[model samples]
Target: MNNLPVQWMAEQSQRGRHLCLILDSTAVPGIHQALLHQLTHEHYRSVYRETAVAALSVGGPFIFSIDSLNPSSLNELLEGQTRDWGWLASIENHSIAILVKHWRERLLIGKRPQQALYRFHDNRVLARALAHLPESAYPEYLGPVISACFWQGEQWATVDNPASGEYPVPDAAQWLATPAPVNQERAILLVNVGQYLLAEHSEDLARLPEALSPRAWLIAQLDLAQRWGWQTPEQLHFLVVERLRETHTPGIKNWEPRPEEHAQAHFERLRGERFPEVKTWR
Candidate 1:
């Protein structure tokens, strides 16, 4: 089985983090399935195995299982009271950012099982975020607030690309909103790079090298905030788009654009009033 050692499970023991293991033997076959099943056994650790909806109905430490995950499952996991997420070689592109935002919020609100999410694909990024844990509870919600704002802008690139959904584009104002947290210690303003570019003749405002590319703006934003005395805005996050190279039925591998490039391209296209360096990126 393609399993990491059982000791890796110790990461969840940290305060304010609950891990939910989503099970799908069909989604993952061969060694992946075998490893996950090992975790489910008595020798492994805490696990839950039910659909997201069913998982919500019970007390957590949820070893929840989902047959397949889509927007519907994403909504259930967030909207439902039991907020737990365990990734076993199965994290989808569309869902992760949104789920992370809410999980951060739940943690800020002093909710138990403060959500701990880890993906096998990008442990480095996860490690970095975890390293900057909030000293107080206020920024937990703010992180998502900032993250969701950036995610919407990134989504545009994918949805509007002809090779992508190629969906009709809408006014940026219609789709984007400021982070709505009550305590103003942290708030983010998402400027639509594309929208701003079309309106203004030049992109001088985004000329600075430090300005993050659109795809990676969220991470950059958080880093920028931390440097400039802005507390980590709860959970601001970034999203990007990537084309699928091959087709796998039932469950296909997901991908996203490189964040740093996305931020830079988007920024270069915008022409607007000078904005402060909101965050930084490593």
Candidate 2:
């Protein structure tokens, strides 16, 4: 079912930039081992290295320099025999290290969804980004990537970089502090992350009132947190705990903390004051 444009990929390989395959290790579990022998350029790296979500980034997204790929290896990727792969991109004159740094800074979207994992390496995200970003942003969005070959709407497609530049990677710390240039596509991706959390923690969802849909509730809570600037992992955990344990704690849905205080501290103080009932973690 994989409509990989083989001929187009071959053409893209020789365009003076290295053609690399970006694989989602979460999707294709042992991607590195699977392509070990066929790796001509061996300059492979996970896009999450040295970032805030490093612990959670295990089996994240991997990018492998693929100036040349063996025929069977290409077949393995396209046969759908394995989990879905990422994208085939032609990157400018930069090594895998350079590319990882380029994508890593973008691992989060807005400032309020602090340190939320961003799968920027995903082809779907790339496709959305192409449509979501302004023409002036193409260079920065496609930084160092000359072109990307991936599945579009219903078939194979390629998105050539509309503009080109060194388009240097930004400092991760600074990027984390500043709101990333707003992109509707990225906002959608962050909400999708919230949905993933809802599904992953479905076991704990039963504690929530039957009238409430955990998915809908969590999205609403995320909006609340964003508005409150309660965006750190600790803050997200505080809100998730409140939802799972007791659906309603004072202002848990929409409380803005003081600028001098953190969400977890505020929630702890509220829990102590209210002394509400709770369920076992199990």
Candidate 3:
């Protein structure tokens, strides 16, 4: 095993930071299984106390250590498998520090071919850091992690290869005009807005519910609006609806009746002749 930098280990230990070392087993086949065997041994238990080693891939190993290790010995162990193991030291509830062996060096879990070697406090910071790396390096799991960390208390979900058909965009006009309580309608609208935003931003939202919590959706909407320079929620809402309408009903021009027209007579017509269409649409 190659020795990790002693000075670095001592410095991190003095700061009482938890350590998370991510190793790419793909670089050295069977490295993850080998390391897992070693790290899980009772003899090495003390050294890797409170450690968690996850096989991010068949060969990739992501290790989290609650206590610091002897850098020299740790490196020596890592060297037995491969000289490409990545090290990260983080303080609980604080920030994470990445070891930059060199520019253009690859890490087990980093943005893909040319992974950026830098410290990040949390997923949000990491997301920004990932942006600097090649798109290939960006991991799928990190998307939800970034969203969850950046927007605390808000539910973050992923949609793998999202398309309009799987998670069809709700008809905004119909959604608003649904015979529901005002709050319920607003909730539905907000969720639709969030779905639209998620689709626009990343195709990952389709894996999640079409709608999350309304309050969280509102927060996300407000933040997105501010970021996109939209002045108001209504403005954002209109944009979302228009986009959905275009996607779902491309050939059909806006056939939704005006709000004023959705009165008693409108309900009667809907109840009578349009009952089948209305029921089918919902």
Ranked by lDDT from best down, the candidates are 2, 3, 1
Off by over 4 Å in 3: 1-4, 29-31, 41-56, 66-69, 77-82, 93-282
Report how far off residue 268 is in candidate 2 (Å): 13
lDDT on C-alpha atoms for all candidate structures: 0.26, 0.62, 0.35
TM-score of 1: 0.20
Model 1: which ten-residue window has the lowest total lDDT?
A: 153-162
Worst 10 residues of 2 by lDDT: 172-181
User: What does candidate 2's lDDT look like per residue over 1-282, in tens digits?
Assistant: 344567666676656677778887766766567665456445677666676555545566778876656645666666565433678877675665666777786666555443355656566666666766666666776677777777544566787777754666544333223234456534543554554454355556666678877666776777777766666665666666555555443434434466677665666555554445742242
Q: Estimate candidate 1's alpha-carbon lDDT, on a 0 to 1 scale.
A: 0.26
What's the CA RMSD for each of the models? Answer: 20.4, 9.0, 19.4
Give the candidate number with the greatest lDDT: 2
In model 3, what lDDT does residue 33 have?
57
lDDT of 3 by residue, 172-272 (tens): 21211224445533443454345334434333333334665434545664555444455434445443443334443353333343466633344334334
Of candidates 3 and 1, the better by TM-score: 3
